[model samples]
Target: IYLPYTGTTIGSFGYVPMEQMEGGKAYAASDLYSLGTTCFHLLTNVHPWDLWKKQGYRWVNSWRKHLKQPVSEQLWWIMDRLLPESYQHRYQSVDQVLEVLEFQSATPANPSQSTSKYHESFLNFLTSLRQNDQLKKQVMMGGVSLLSLGLITQGYGYFRYQTFPSNLSFLIAGLPSSTYLKTTLNGHTNSVRSIAVSPDSQYLVSGSNDHTVKIWDLPKGELVRTLNGHDGNVYSVAITPDGETIASGGDDNTIKIWNLKTGELKNNLTGHQGFISSVAISSDGKTLVSGSYDHTIKVWDLPTGKLKQTLTGETNWVSSVVISPDGKTLVSGNGGNTIRIWDLDTGNLKKTLTGHRDSVVSLIISPDGKTLFSSSLDRNIKIWDLTIGELKNTLTGHIYYVHSLAISPDGKTLVSGSANNTIKVWNVETGELKNTLTGHTNWVSSLAISPDGKTLVSGSRDDSIKLWKLP
Candidate 1:
């Protein structure tokens, strides 16, 4: 039995301590020891093997000194019981650990009472672990039953007294609310063309025809800063996954990168001859892809702003660009009513997907990078199989041209903004229209989903941005 880290695997058994490996027999206490090591590593920001090589079990005794937060005596006692070098001295059963945790919960040992920041940070770390599919599968297969229970208890203890955003409740699998408009942000002097949200969900950036980019405090809908650098109408905007940089493309035929926190210009990329229309950053945040009226897509080195590759096979103006999560494939929608898939490593065309009767206006790849969603001026949204390059389904609900599309973080729901002044939410797998959001009085030009999958932001030609509480 073992506790898997980010890069650990079952085949990598040499990582086990020498004493545990020599026995060739795993006990319940062995599992507890491994979990305790994992907890110590996470708390101290050091690898277990490094500490074991230097100081053996003595590393556990000094772990508290390395922690960023103060640990309570009850918690320290629990940790001590789990890290004993002798199996007889360690925890013998899952029930024993739970009993300790339950008793600790009743006392003032709760981390939230003394160090709320530490508890919040630890909660975020556990939430990320739960979201990791590979780690979850490995733990289930390894049969580490107690670790699962411990994670659940920790989650409950942290979240029980904390208040989350109202829309967060709707992110649950079966909990659907009556969708409603939450607030309207009115700062763009002209039609808002594009929008992007930071990965932390704390800030929103919007590009407008007024030739400026505005950053807003997401929850409060208050304007934070106005960026005025573009000489032409800003057409597209994107935020890096790290939430440190902002990229925008405009009719000035240039791509500008800015420091998101400081609002300072970082780099200016120039190559496109026509108006830039769409921009997307790879999941790794190393590559930036942009599409323009020049009928081409250009890939750039994000840090240096140097051109890496230019794709120029499209016959019409490129309207949308998206990169697969793996950063191996690039997908672009063109005014020629087609979608093209390119191999990022080789800069070669892989396939052309054709189904829309009119120009393809927006494109988004599913979270798993298996399905491609495209919206078109044909008034329809087409779902395509990324592996086989075939159309799987077509959703027809919008009365006018569909302008933009966004998928939830879980890839379970899709929202499309249309020229008919309405936004439609659909079940991605079933192609069923779940709800129709009607608030924008003019054409909805852009759409973005928050990283938490709870809030949906839409920008319109009506010169306003609306935040929708998703169901």
Candidate 2:
């Protein structure tokens, strides 16, 4: 099927697919081609644009030759299907690529000499790219697509927005804002409060004030099923480390766990006397943590739904909770504009981080477990060194309350959703504002970054979830 577009060549050169360049028509596969190009550039440290002027699409055919070291033939095969010059030869759907990804990446040709040996990127086909600092920086490369013009750039936010006279004024400024968006999921009748993506990045789970948790299939952004159980507005949702279970907290003052595949209610844990605001699972998949307006954090055995410990002494209600990747430390953002560091193994408060001027609503840690990022009603994102309990950097730009934060798999980029109806992209290490994305009509309540760092999902108060193709 063909989707008509203007004849102008608006994107950075080589990343544009053949269909977009030849006939002014594009399809879903065009983005696949663009993704493949990004993968290739990550594998070979060569910008696709550098080859576009001379070799054109021909360069994609022999991409492996530029690889500095060995890449499994299996990986090369997947790229073969992705980087093909024609849509017919490419993977017809993103689901198709996801289906075969695991089988092709079971083992590398040379385990010792892996992606890092060739390039610094943690771009693995099936494996968690944060293989070891794999996600140390967010989306390893800035990705672009000419087809949708939605994903302008990745690692650095400079290219994300259709800027004013300072940047590309000729094309994007003349186009509608809808031109910057590819997918918007509308199902929840109330504001979407929080969202999470599966570890594999195939499914999205959103908790809404509509008293429902919705699971959506990726790429297609189609509603897979609607989960109903919470008695009040659903406030937070978290997919387990294994992605087989989903834990949801809400105004109901309860935590409900559901089967990821069957949508069955597996268990409901009741204890909190106040509204449950956040839920988090440890990396080991054995521990569950919840934060509530009851002014306490509860630790439970995830498999049994049995309560293990109740942490108190909080000056304000708990709003958000997150565990380090190592499963040893627990961090909670509290209503008193403070963050409490707890020892998960001992259930003791390790330290208190006080910096925000308002309630801290969101928390996310770098994959390596060395850093912690927190956002608050203060309209700021605070970066802290997790080991020493010291503040590192404070990122400020959001005009309103920062409601959510997500770090790309590369751990390089940090994306924050705000009540101002915008998503701001940041350079995690430098605390610099990369770019601001505008589309949501209401507050951007929640945000999630896919494991591969290719997609960014934002849930809004407008009662819609938008799937963004990362740059």
Candidate 3:
């Protein structure tokens, strides 16, 4: 689709912003103007070239004059942003444009349908305009119904019908992926720092900055018990494979064990001088690992609460730690931009994998124990071949720090929780991002997958836990 430019100009006529016509530069906003013009032409039968010949840049200001029929305020606002004469006034990126589209086309017909709901009250604006039957027919005849009022009606059945109007589907498909949001569990007084799902998939334990560990009935989303013993914020939580005991580590530099069924404080282990950042229980539920701001990875006996060994050499904070499913390896991520592989029992550091330029925020091993995924403050998720101890691939999509990583039990899908307040579902084999699920208003701090791999649980700085169906 190359356009024949007369001299210093490119891009198709009226769709081009004034800055580009003057041989300045083209930006994302310039492309947005083109999209807006296309949507306008589709809705009103008014060609952009004819308008460019008549009013030039001033045409956008009086765009409504050519409209024979009216459009909903939500649709009007979306078109208004896309058709701004100045690039500075247009939507800066495609995400911003689609964000508006999703918000405007939102449906509250069911909880699952509105899980992707951003701001519903946005449609309350621009309703004073008269309704247009012709415009609705024009959109219906054309598959691209950006101005479809049926989307705004009581039915709002895109999900109900299990289909979407063609061109609008393309836009929605690329934006935040539609997901079935199960429920939001809120109880923490502060940031919910970490979360873990029981092996039986019946319970979920969450650690929070509120200095408490709360257990919830997973199926019902009901708060079961809140264990309060940590003097400071509970930074990490890990449940045993048997689902009998839970270990919680916190800012108070203590790891407390509790009965998952009875909510009894079993033992409190203390050794590290700094705040605990992460805790992991092995698949066998025999060994427990803790990484801390104290710059060391401590291995402890899960049943007896005795300090086994402290693997040291890190000059910075140990941000996260995890045990392999086979129960033979220990991986620790630190603020020093390196991942440490250690012999779980010997406390010997085997290899220090380096690729991330910033702090490694989280680490997770594949179920098969063949691959390791590490997230970092560099905004990259690196996949490593544990056997070779080398980088396999780097997944780059998150705009902010990749805070946490979780993998389904089958090891085919990987999900990353980001500081951008969104969770990205990725295909492990191809490294392709399958979906970008957004709802949380703050940083997504931690993620856990149910044993059956059907549900995903996320803990966020918004002080809420969101359960989402695997897309």
For TM-score, the strongest prediction is 3
Cα RMSD to the true fold for all candidates: 24.8, 22.2, 17.1
For each candidate, what is the lDDT? 0.77, 0.75, 0.76
Candidate numbers sorted by TM-score from highest down = 3, 2, 1
Q: Residues 209-273, candidate 1, lDDT per residue (tens digit)?
A: 88999999998889999998998779999999999999999988999999988899999999998
Give one digit per residue, the lDDT tens place, for model 3 in 316-353.
78889999888888999887788999888787889999
Which of candidates 2 and 3 is the stronger one according to lDDT? 3
Residue 350 miss distance in model 3 (angstroms): 0.9
Better of 1 and 3 by TM-score: 3
Clashes of each: 0, 13, 0
Candidate no. 2 TM-score: 0.63
Off by over 4 Å in 3: 1-178
Q: Lowest summed lDDT over 10 consecutive residues: which window, candidate 2? A: 156-165
Model 1 regions more than 4 Å off? 1-179
Q: Against the hidden reference, what TM-scores do the models get?
A: 0.63, 0.63, 0.64
Q: Model 1, poorest ten-residue lDDT window? A: 163-172
